[model samples]
Target: MTLEENAREHPYEPVPGDVVRDAATRRVGRVMDRMGLRVQLRPLNGGREWDAMPQDLSPASQSDAMSAAVAEANAQSWRGR
Candidate 1:
């Protein structure tokens, strides 16, 4: 099989635009892109990006997504003050 085919057989890595959570911290961020071998994510509001392994991430639940978004908004407002 071709290398592409082999990679296709493996489990999907979160693609850019997917909302994911860090398994360790439960931090919610949107998938950015793969960096070297790590999956990159950015905060809901706008902050430094973080890298995580696909195994260390899972799709964020609706409640978790909402909470994260709210937290980000609060942070932005606080920063503006």
Candidate 2:
């Protein structure tokens, strides 16, 4: 499919707490919440939240997903949370 079509039909459909990547800013974050037509995303490492249009984001790249998953696993192992 075309790029615009793909962007519109983005497969992720982010939910709160799920990780996502913004196309415009190239920022990877966790979905925090939704407000109207915008989605709120917070830094995966904990920081201020930002608003982004859901259509502007895609699923995190495989490498990024792996890195985040490894980090999360390590954090869970260390913190027991």
Candidate 3:
């Protein structure tokens, strides 16, 4: 299978916009899809798993912070795996 297929089968990486609510740590993922940057999101009450892309994400003021967090999460995830 191709690399993408392999990743899908064994998702060692997190996809962009995955709502991660693991225990006390909670975050909405805002990944740089091309770079696979996984940012931690500020918790919300409840919403769909996928959200608008960072460029088109609502409440645009937070885009920069979200992107930075995603980059950090991507780095950390890659290192851990």
User: CA lDDT, every prediction?
Assistant: 0.87, 0.79, 0.42
TM-scores of the candidates in the order shown? 0.79, 0.65, 0.26
Candidate 3 clashing pairs, residues 3+ apart or interchain: 28-41, 38-70, 39-69, 39-70
Residue 56 CA error for candidate 2 (Å)? Answer: 0.7
- Ranked by TM-score from best down, the candidates are 1, 2, 3
Candidate with better lDDT, 1 vs 3 = 1
Per-candidate clash tally: 0, 0, 4
Off by over 4 Å in 2: 1-11, 65-81
Residue 81 of candidate 3: its Cα lDDT? 89
Overall local distance difference test of candidate 2 = 0.79
CA RMSD of all predictions: 6.1, 5.1, 15.1
Q: In candidate 2, what residue range of length 10 has the lowest lDDT sum?
A: 64-73
Query: Per-residue lDDT of 11-47 in model 1, one digit per residue for the tens?
Result: 5578999998898667999999898889999998779
Clashing pairs in 1: none
State how far residue 22 of model 2 sits from its true place (Å).
0.4
Q: Poorest 10 consecutive residues of model 1 by lDDT?
A: 3-12
Output the TM-score of candidate 1: 0.79
Find the candidate with the highest TM-score and give its number: 1
Indicate whether candidate 2 or candidate 3 has the larger lDDT: 2
- Model 3: per-residue Cα lDDT over 1-81, one tens digit each: 998697567654334454333323333343334333333344333223333323323222365446546676677678778
